[model samples]
Target: MTRRRLFVGLMVVALIVCMSTTLFGAASVRRYAYSASNPGGVWYTMCGGIVKLLQEKLPSNIRVDMIASGGSVLNTRRLASGEADLTMAYSTHLWECWNGEGIMKGRPNDNPRIMFEIYKSDHYFVTLANSGIKSMKDLEGKRVVLGPPGSGSSDNSRFTLRTLGINAIESELAFGDAAQALAEGKVHAMGMSGSPAAGLVEVAATRDIYIIPFTDEELDKIVSAGPFFSKGVMPANTYQGQTKDVPVFMFTVYQVASKNVPADDVYEMMKVCFSPEGKEYLGAVHPYWKTMKNDPELVKALGIPYHPGAERFWREQEQKK
Candidate 1:
């Protein structure tokens, strides 16, 4: 071959190699980004575990990145802006964002969708076991940590407290740090709403304080306000010092994704989250994972409509019925 032809042949081979590399890279890797407000919280831990499981179960090209965020509101906004592929949020806030209610009062997000309900967050107004704080009414004059301003706990705490005619002042702190603050007696009591045996609660309990259970009257007041709030009982043994089921208003925690995420991705994500292996993964991540067993009825309880992909999953399940 002439020198020029040889050079041209080399150039053509280089072009083919470059094109093949680009296609291989695109096909070999799937990138997913996630963020959680309280990285040390149970939800983040469980979600992180799932992400890890995905890495193990998914093709080698799939990569998942977890980012720490400022809880529900921030996560919701991120999802709407297409900054996050998935996030954890409370069902009530999900609705408020969807309908532009409450703290989401002025800004509204209509593009988020529920992938599945994760667990129940039973609101607890806990004081030091020895603090002489017995009920919601008892905390009226005490200094209370309301939880961080935009967190699911903060929203539910304010609503629950208001429902009971108790107007305790709120001190805001990030979720992971709240328990430590409580242990140091920086705040009279901290509001915990979510699953019974969550890591946060475990941290609080290990501090040698008691969990003050809410009264039926207080629980009734919250439920009466809206279906977003419901009665959830925390069995006594859920905590070390507790002995009876503590009745309180509970909120649903859900896994939500942007409206733009593909249906197949959401479907596969849900299946992975609820699978037997997923359950085991959750159990290892946090005791709260024990609360994540798949419940079909939970889809109906979500405050907002399911994502189209989620809806398809439920519809297919229904078709079998």
Candidate 2:
């Protein structure tokens, strides 16, 4: 009886040792949640590509997961609340969040730090070719879908219309749903931002589309409205039935990290994202990635500070040049 008891006690000790090892191994892997826009949008696709690249390049102990949220405004909130470790937001929105101005007034969130400028998101005002809405002025009484609620695109659309004194009935919808509404004639126009938006491409596939370009005077008013606004051109053939260059007001989209994130991790992420392998992979994922550059001047133009890790990485790049 004594010998049998001894053997059972030894087995119990071994089992506890195995369980402890398993728990420790699981705890050692640090997973970070990255916030981005809803699926079926360019931001969503590009962010997925970035997360995949990070997963492959980052150490096995560090994992990054992408979470789909409303858009820029919500993403910023998430970063400030510690709900997200990284996020994508517009330069205008980031500036407001940092300075406690505009929509972010009285709720300043200074924790967001720029990692890099992702791409130029040009505003697109799309209408069906037969709608007869040839310019921004013509949409005064028309129903317009102004992007999802709390999205940067929505804020931008409202600001542009208000600045130019063009008031239209506005509806907030996701990119895919908005495209469907436009196709069904439920809405007269839709506003979108991003390079070669997937929703616009999908809509153009079935119906002839017209992108209303901003006039020279309108561009001047938009640029004068804020430092974040700039004139941009959408190249000819950017979409089906678009045969000429379309002038548009644009804003920069940036990837930002929380200040709580370790500087070393942010630095490593910048290194992997800017590496030749990373660029090739991202460019293939979307044409927007091709717009990314190593220029620190662009970061400076954001009018906000960079993550220490990102700043360190950029400083090294500057020295190499």
Task: Report, for every candidate in turn, its global Cα lDDT versus the true structure.
Answer: 0.71, 0.87
Where in model 1 is the C-alpha error above 4 Å? 1-5, 12-16, 23-28, 196-206, 290-303, 315-321
lDDT of 1 by residue, 89-205 (tens): 877777777777765687787768877767777777666777777767788878887666556667677777777778787787876677677667677888766554254566645
> Each model's number of backbone clashes?
8, 0
| Cα deviation of 148, candidate 1, in Å | 3.4
The deviation in Å at residue 233 for candidate 2 is: 1.2
The stretch of ten residues in a row with the least summed lDDT in candidate 1 is 195-204
Global Cα lDDT for candidate 2: 0.87
lDDT of 2 at 214: 93
What's the C-alpha lDDT at position 8 in model 2?
98
TM, every model? 0.84, 0.94
Candidate 1 RMSD to the correct structure: 3.1
lDDT of 2 by residue, 105-207 (tens): 8888778898888887898689999999999999999999988887877888888899999989999999889988999999999888885888889889999
Residue 199 deviation, candidate 2, in Å? 1.2
